[model samples]
Target: MDDKEMLFNSGILTEEREGAILPPEELWKNKKGGLVVVECPQRIPCNPCATSCPTGAIRPFSDINDTPSVDHSKCTGCTLCVASCPGLACFVIDLTFSDDLALYKLPYEMLPLPVKGEKVLCLDREGKCIAEGTVENITQPRKDRTYVIHVSAPKNLVREFRAIRVVK
Candidate 1:
């Protein structure tokens, strides 16, 4: 099953089945400029996303089941959470990079992945491609399903891209 499916079956999220997050417009608008909001889908056994952080950005707060916290102040926009999160809930956002744009980093698990500078379609949380973007960066593949891809697109598309699509 996909991550969404697993999250639903595990009963960790309160949203409708397969839906784990609220609208960014409601949950994160006008918040801290660089704060990255993460939706913890479930309370499954995992804490690497918290411990793997070098700057202590991911807050453990003395509980393994607690959701991880990324302090944007010290995040450095590192992709460590992309590689460390067993559930793939982490993402990085840079709002100041462009006046009308934002950079997003997401965990990619599909095959025939994208490369740097390659133009690809950007999808939202529902897996719908809503914008075109250039792959500005990609994290090296490790022993897990985690791989972070950085995409640059128009500012409005910033909230729409939750996934990446390689152009045919």
Candidate 2:
């Protein structure tokens, strides 16, 4: 089946679909802080990602069902939207973290939160363990319960790493 068909049938975003929503190459590659990546493919009636953007990088929606359109130039990668997205589709990738590693900030709501410097099992879109990663930081906004977990993993796996499991 085609990527879109598989995505619709399985609810796991294919590489093509995910790439389609990514910020421009130059902007995401050259931007210092990082860039916000909204993986929300379905056009549902949701606006938290857009409304929570402090820089207006996630453009205001014309309709409630509009998918997020990011203006990468204005994005500071503060990750406020990551914390606010109920669907947990938002992420931030910082390629400048290291030569061999990329920093990924993902929305995590699971209990027994991992701590900084803890080793973790990096998971892909299907919740399958793909690689080992380290928890660099975990930000829990007082207002929102959704925690944003910062992880560092191999740069080559940037497209594959989505979520993490706390290793026992």
The top-ranked prediction according to lDDT is 2
lDDT of 2 by residue, 12-98 (tens): 999787678777888777677689888888889999999889899999999999989888899998989999999999999998898
Query: Each model's TM-score?
Result: 0.71, 0.95
Across 1-168, the per-residue lDDT of candidate 1 in tens digits comes to 675776577534333532333223443444333345466755656798777777786676476766555554455556676677767777766665576767777788887888888998888766677888888888854565588887877766644566787876
Residue pairs in steric clash, candidate 1? 100-155
Cα lDDT of all candidates, in order?
0.66, 0.88
Candidate 1 minimal-lDDT segment of 10 residues: 14-23
Off by over 4 Å in 1: 1-35, 141-145
